[model samples]
Target: MAVLDIKNLNVAYKSRNEKVFAVDNVSLSISEGDSVGIVGESGSGKSTLAMAILRLLSENDTEITGEIDFKGKDLLKMDINEFNKIRWKELAVVFQKSMNALSPIHKIGSQLEDIYRVHEPKIAKQKLKEKILSLFKLVNLSDRVYNLYPHELSGGMLQRVSIALSLIHKPPLLILDEATTALDVVTQGQILSEIQKLEQDIKMTRIMITHDMSVVANSCKKVVVMYAGKIMEVGNVEDVLIKPTHPYTQGLMKSFPTLKGEKKELSGIKGFLPNMSEKNKGCIFAPRCSFVQEVCHKVAPKEFEIKSGHLSACHLHGSEIN
Candidate 1:
């Protein structure tokens, strides 16, 4: 069974004047031990999708629809109490900023203890301390660092601690929302290597959400490309990253730098994401797409199968490669 399955999931934010749909009818299934990357530019709702899965959005500002099934349980229907039971046990989140995630005043050890204290109540305090120490070792931290506060550790160490805390319960799914965004290249590589080791060692499933295609290309087995709150494409990482069917995907790949080749100036997508509250008549990317036609401006394109296990939402699906 799929560890995570989201179908027709839609999320909207409310204001006094209108509702803004941030995620629009997106569907995805992640099997056990699978590594999936959701890639998109900022404002494309990639982070919102992750937050929605965790049921972390503030209820007053947002409305969610459709299903978020985790191991046959409908997460959308779970009450707060039941959801709390699942948060750090069945599903865990490694948010984008480790600084914001870790508490400044609390000792690192205490924070680690809190995960077990909340979820695995049956365990005694002594056992929890032992487990937290074991977790520190598992993430390659020195035992002495456990007593240090968040400010005492380096950025890399804090991020590693954040990762260790997230794995405290050995949850089935680990959602890394740009977890390495703040680190240097060397540190990021180290963390990525550690993540790969953990995945292989435990047969864990991971969902890495990042706009960096290089990270997605190196880490994920499957890829989902999002643009303006809609999925532009989904396919095997090798196939989609190497031979992107969507124009947007192609543009993203072209923008990546290579060591052995001549360096070119990097450029971002030209136009802005359309306002969600505004009435969008057709494809959301039509304004920025270089290959857009009249049909793209007048009607939304249906998702078409470009190859086995490769699908794209573009008008040129059956035509010449973009």
Candidate 2:
């Protein structure tokens, strides 16, 4: 069954006199225990989609439309209080920077305890401490580090702590928004490995939002490629990564280095992303696509089902709409 279902979701931010579209008519469904990766360059709306799923965008200046159904309930229609009850307990996020997420003034254990107490106010202090320690071990952190401050740990260790904290309540859905971006190569691998193990052991659903293809290859079973606030392709990770259907996805794959294959020089996609403030009437990626035709510039293509469990949005793929 699908754990989260989003349909025709649109997000726009008002700037001066214009509304900039950050996400446009995007629809996705994530099944239980599935690890899906949202990949794109900056401003591709990957993070915006993640934030929108949790309703974390600013209410005053941002306009969000369409349905966000989480576990059968429409989160977009929920009251703030109702959503709060589900936020940390059912859905949790580990943001990009661990340093900013952690409290510099509070000890790790105390901060974790505060989060636990907020949800379980009457729990005994000793039991909470034990739970915290166990979570620490689960993320491969030593119990000694639990008493230390954020600055006392390395960036990698701090990230591990952040992961541990997110799993404190064992939320059914955990979103990692560039959670491993700042770590070194080896450290990122270790953390990703641990996360995969945790997902298997706990049956947790994960949404890994990142620009790194290698990260998706390592940790995700499915991949969604985004460009200019729209999803260009989505499918099984091996299918999308190994045999990209969309031009944008192909460009992204070519731009990144691979470990197993014969080494090739990286070639980044050309041209800049279109200004979000302007209305796009045709394919958003037409300007940069090498195979762009007149039709691509004049008409927008709907998502086409390339095969079972695979979808792509591109005129070159023809009109096999899914």
Candidate 1: segments with Cα more than 4 A from true spot: 124-127, 138-140, 260-266, 318-322
Across 171-198, the per-residue lDDT of candidate 2 in tens digits comes to 9999999988877887678777877887
Report the Cα RMSD per candidate: 2.0, 2.3
Question: Which candidate has the top score in TM-score?
Answer: 2
Off by over 4 Å in 2: 318-322
lDDT of each: 0.85, 0.89
RMSD of candidate 1 to true structure, Å? 2.0
Q: What is the lDDT of residue 171 in candidate 2?
A: 90
| lDDT of residue 248 for candidate 1 | 88
Q: Residue-wise lDDT of candidate 1 within 1-322, one digit each (tens)?
A: 6889999999999889899889998998888888999998888899999999999999999999999999898998999999998888889988877556778899988877875778776888788888788777766678888789988988877887888888888788999998878667776776677777778888789999997888888888999999878999999999898788898887787777755567777766777789887657788898998899999999988899988878999998735464
- Clashes per candidate, residues 3 or more apart or on different chains: 0, 0
